[model samples]
Target: MTVADTPQAAAFRRQVLIPLKLRLFLMQKLPMAWLAGLRLRQLTPEQAVVTIRFKFLTQNPFRSIYFACLAMAAEFASGIQAMMHVQAGGPVSMLVVKLEGDFTKKAVGLIAFTCPDGPLIAQAVAESCATGEGRTVVCTSTGVDEAGDVVAIFRLTWSFRAKC
Candidate 1:
């Protein structure tokens, strides 16, 4: 079973996200798909908000945010939110079996993806911990760019399993 679905697990997960320096360094080292300026904001028990600036220097010269980059942003936010929902006792292996995206519009400015559909994640996480059975959690990925316009909508599906 996983540890992150319970109150104890959530609290423990919060403890592990405390290293700002490490977080920043890792952000910098990650592949180009992620905007180094990615910022995470906590909204609620089952919600997570991630913000990223569209930078020309790190992007293609076409003067538009790349589709793959946007997809990565959505995927990363979803994975982290899922991880935060489980395994507070220790780390777990996560995988993305299926993912679908709808490009609503081009990301114009700093973009934010909200995990408003967190119930699916929270419920699946709780169920996994209770039964020690692995399952998939589905979450929505909504992206809005700097102009306060919708840039993309995505459906992220992830399968969680204990790292043991």
Candidate 2:
């Protein structure tokens, strides 16, 4: 059986993964995220929503949010879902193997990055555990402006492997 296919692991995920305090502490450690004013607005087993304020720190000379800052928010949205899965299943190693971004519209004001691919990530992890081989999944995170317009879309490829 996979490490995450256990009752204890599920309990740990419930008690540790979805806590606001832990998320706040995590943000503190990520200085760039903190400086860019990234916030974890919501997180669940199925989705994660992250936001970045288009303030001076996050803005580029073009009067829009910096590309890197947008990338950071998008990554957080995608990564948080994978984090939840890995935390619940067992000690697994996960990394972003690839990233593709489309700057659809100028990112202005507060941007919300939303990713809804938790089930897909969980399946990839289970596959890796069953096969004892690495599995990769592509997750898409979309950034929306405060006016609900599409700002950017990022496709991230994540590789997962169970620890030996």
Candidate 3:
């Protein structure tokens, strides 16, 4: 069975699909993301979409969403997928080891960041768990504006290690 079909992954998916549960998760575990108004728009076995809007809390003096906020959304897009995979299997620790971002346009209005690297992340997590060694994968998250224009691209390298 696919990682997403596992009971733990299914449970995590259900928890995230509920807006109130997701909000409470962010409020308790990630206050900055909660304050920045980050929202998870979609989550699937192979993809995740997160959004951030240009609001007072997320905006910068430049009249646009701050770069850090954009990065947070992008990271969440990939991180959520990794989280699902980690939950599907045995205990594993995940962390973002590196992050690189490229801004192609000003981020205004609602920006959606999508990551289509769930399978890749799943493999890494599974390998780490099986081998009891660390594994790393680079997941790319692309951000687009409301008009469908590319706003930013972020490559986040995540490391996973199985726990004893």
- lDDT score for residue 143 of model 1: 91
Model 3 per-residue lDDT tens digits across residues 51-132: 9999999889999999999999999999999999999989999999999999999999999999999999999988998999
Candidate 2 lowest-lDDT run of ten: 1-10
Residue 92, model 1, lDDT = 51
TM-scores for all candidates? 0.77, 0.86, 0.97
True-structure Cα RMSD, model 1: 3.9
Cα error, residue 68 of model 1, in Å, equals: 1.9
Candidate 3, poorest ten consecutive residues by summed lDDT: 1-10
Per-residue lDDT, model 3, residue 65, is 91
After superposition, which runs of candidate 3 have C-alpha atoms over 4 Å from their true positions? 1-4
Best by lDDT: 3
The candidate, 1 or 3, that scores higher on lDDT is: 3
By TM-score, who's the top model here? 3
Q: Candidate 2: misplaced stretches above 4 Å?
A: 1-24
Ranking by TM-score: 3, 2, 1
